[model samples]
Each structure stands twice: as structure tokens, then as C-alpha cells.
Target: MTRVKISRVTKVPASEAPPASGECPPSGIRLTTDDGDAAMGLRVVGIHLENCGKQDYSVDGYPLLELMDKDLSPVQGISIVQGSGGISTGTGFDEPARPLVLKPGESALSGLMWRNTTESGPTANIPYVRVRAKQGADPVTVTPQLDLGTTGKLAVRPWTRPSK
Candidate 1:
């Protein structure tokens, strides 16, 4: 779904390598990814959860994706629907999840729509995505390459507080 490239994420640009910006992982939170945005076929990716570590940091729902494949393993059949369970329709990803708390440096926002459009079989170019800012929290691998042409499905949008 990234054959269009629109780009638009003002922050979350702190990187030190760890597969590509997602370093802070001692429960401090810091996952970045936003070089994604396509049009007509829908495909937006933006997952920046930054807390820099100090104290307060919480999450509510939908931030536990897997889909890895640049030698990171874990890619099986896709299908990670949470908000836009309807595939896609107006962008907001169907909208629903609410509950967050980041302090220290504060920053929270999540998203990952999909559509890619293909018609045959076999097509899920996910370069890596191991995020997990919920349910036990502690697993960030950021790098939303995801092309998912066959449309295996991947729509997550929760954890707000980033209208930039």
C-alpha cells in the first residue's frame, strides 16, 4: 500500500538504530515509523509512542502487531484488525480506542491502515513490525515497510494524543 507515498508526521524522529528507530526498550517506550502514506488505494502508517522514560507511561488498546520478515521471522498470515475492521473507509480507521498516559517526554499515537490491492495470491511484503505498547508492553521493532498487496488485512488505530 505504499506505492503512492504522501508523507506527514512532524515528530518522532529520534533514532539510534535497532532495526531503525525504536531503541528505548526498558519499558521507557519509543517506537517510531511514519514514512508511509498512499492514496487512492489507502495505506497509512504512523506509530510513534514516545515516553523517553522517567515514570508515567500507559496504553489502552491496539498496538500489538507482529508481521516481521526481514529475517525477523514471525510473518504467517497477517490479519491484525482492531479499529478499521472494515478494511478501510474514510481514514480514521473506524475510530474507537481511547486511553493513554505518557509523561516524561510525552507522545502517543497509533495507526496502520491497509489496502495495497493485488488480485492473485501470495503478496505480503512486510519488512518488519514487532510493536507492543499494550498487554504486558515491551517489544518495539518499528520499520513499517508493509506492502501487503493481497490485502491480508491490517487496520489498527488507537492510543491518541498527537494531532500534529
Candidate 2:
């Protein structure tokens, strides 16, 4: 059955950035499946990079997602995976790469999914997630932050394969 529902919500972070101690950001990020696309028998997913706070700039660093518990605790031992380059469907290319650098007042969408490996099988005690970018780049810093809304929480699902 196809169902369309418009849910309205507003979320605000307690702070624009995390403290200087490296802690998980608060629970403000939300993930919702694109049922409309999936309903058409597609493997497409949508990720919303909501309010990531204010930062001077961002650049040059690998972004990663960290999973946490309901009490706002790290879910020790879990890997998150994401992909952006579009895939082929036997005819032609559907998505093309054209620089996905998002600035303030901007958001990016791509095909992404999360799985828990701290021990398998659909679990849903998600609390919050943080995005970490490695330090030291070049002219600008690309160090990802846990409060940038760039990181997303792990869906309450288990993994089918191990990340090595």
C-alpha cells in the first residue's frame, strides 16, 4: 500500500558546536526513508543534512559517522557506510558527479545506509550521531565535527557482512 504523509517537525541543537573534549552531538538528526522512491522499486535513499550549526569553513578531511545509544552513549563497535557516485541501471547513468561541497544554507543528498555490527540483528536504541573529519588539511580545515549535522545515526538494523 502506498501512503503519503506530511509530518512537520522543528529541531534545534543545544549548541552550534561541540565542546573541546570531543563528545557526541545531541539528538537532533533525524533519518527518514524515501518511501515514494522505494515504492517504485528503486534502491535509492535520501539523507538530509539538517542544521549543522555555524562554522567558519570546512574542507579536506574524511567524514565518518558514529553510532550512539539512547542515553547518548557510543555504541562501541559499529561501522557506517555511505556512497555517492551514481550507479547504472542497464540503460544509462542516472546520477552524475558535480562537486558535492555543501556550504551554509545548503544540503546534500545521496544514497546511504547504516548497519550495526556491535552484534547483529535490527536494534533500535539510537541516541545521537557525530561526524568526524580528520585534522590538518591545507588552506581550510576539513575536520568534521560531531555537531555539524553532517553525521547521521545508524538505523536500527544489523549487518549482513563485516567491514574489514
Candidate 3:
């Protein structure tokens, strides 16, 4: 018998993330993403938020995400679930969101998860995402290029402190 590797995760360090076109000012925070990973058709992209302000920054719950097309218009018919929702077990997204206060230069994380399987109808290829660290927060656009192949659902993890 032989064993073959079926999945792998690709981590893109924040220091090396490609330049994104989104910008939000006066919020004292910055949003960026990793290159993303695909494990056996399950896609995961890490969303990172850092407090770059002079004072402490706080957030609780998941980051609000609005999927957008290349034109930056909202994409319809897609569902954003809070947890894995059975999409895949053992994903880190299952953890509950807790309130976090980050000092300047500290960072927190969340993630976008989905599976691309085209069964019927058209596929969704999102070129941009409008993200808010919390409700009523200013929106910042990010280019993750989500390739949702008719899955019609995306899951998000809660904001959490990065493990030391």
C-alpha cells in the first residue's frame, strides 16, 4: 500500500503579501490577506487586521464581508455562514468569536472558507471583497479573487488573537 498527500496549506506572510488596492483611514486599523490555500477543493484565505493607531483597537465577532465582482458591485445569491456549517470539519473557523482589544502594532485574524464544485448553474468568481472589522466600521476593499464554483456559500471565522 502507498500513501499520497491529498492536501496542503499555503501561507503568505503579512510582510510579503502582494500590494492590495484597499485603504481606510482614521480607523486606526489595516486589513490584508494571505495568498490562500486549497485543500482537497476546500479553499481558505486568512484575513489579517492590525492596529496601527496610537491607541488600542478593539473588535468582537466576525469581520463583515461583502463579495464583489470585478466591477466592485455586490454579488447576489451567496450565503455567508458564521462557522464551518459542515463545509469541512476540523477547520479553525469553528472557534467562537470573542471580544479582543489590541494594542498598537498587535494583530488579529479571521478567515474565509469555501468549496468550489460546479454542479449546476453559473460559477461565481469574485475579484474583490468589501470588509469591515466590525459593524458600522468603515469598509475596505480587498482582492482575494474568490473562485466560488457554484457552491453558493462562504464561511467565516471569528476575529481571534494570533497564537504566539
Task: Please tell me which predicted candidate would have the highest TM-score against the true structure.
Answer: 3
lDDT string for model 2 (58-141, tens) is 322233445444444566644343332222242112333333344443443333333222334444434355443323311111
> What lDDT does the true structure give each of the candidates?
0.76, 0.32, 0.83
**Cα RMSDs, all models:** 13.8, 12.9, 8.1
Superior by TM-score: candidate 2 or candidate 3 = 3
List TM-scores for all candidates, in order.
Answer: 0.33, 0.34, 0.83
Best by lDDT: 3
C-alpha root-mean-square deviation, candidate 1: 13.8
Q: Which regions in candidate 1 have their CA more than 4 angstroms from the true location? A: 1-27, 30-52, 55-70, 73-89, 93-102, 116-118, 125-127, 130-139, 142-147, 151-164
Error of 3 at 90 (Å): 1.0
Worst 10 residues of 1 by lDDT: 8-17
Better of 1 and 2 by TM-score: 2
Q: What does candidate 2 score on TM?
A: 0.34
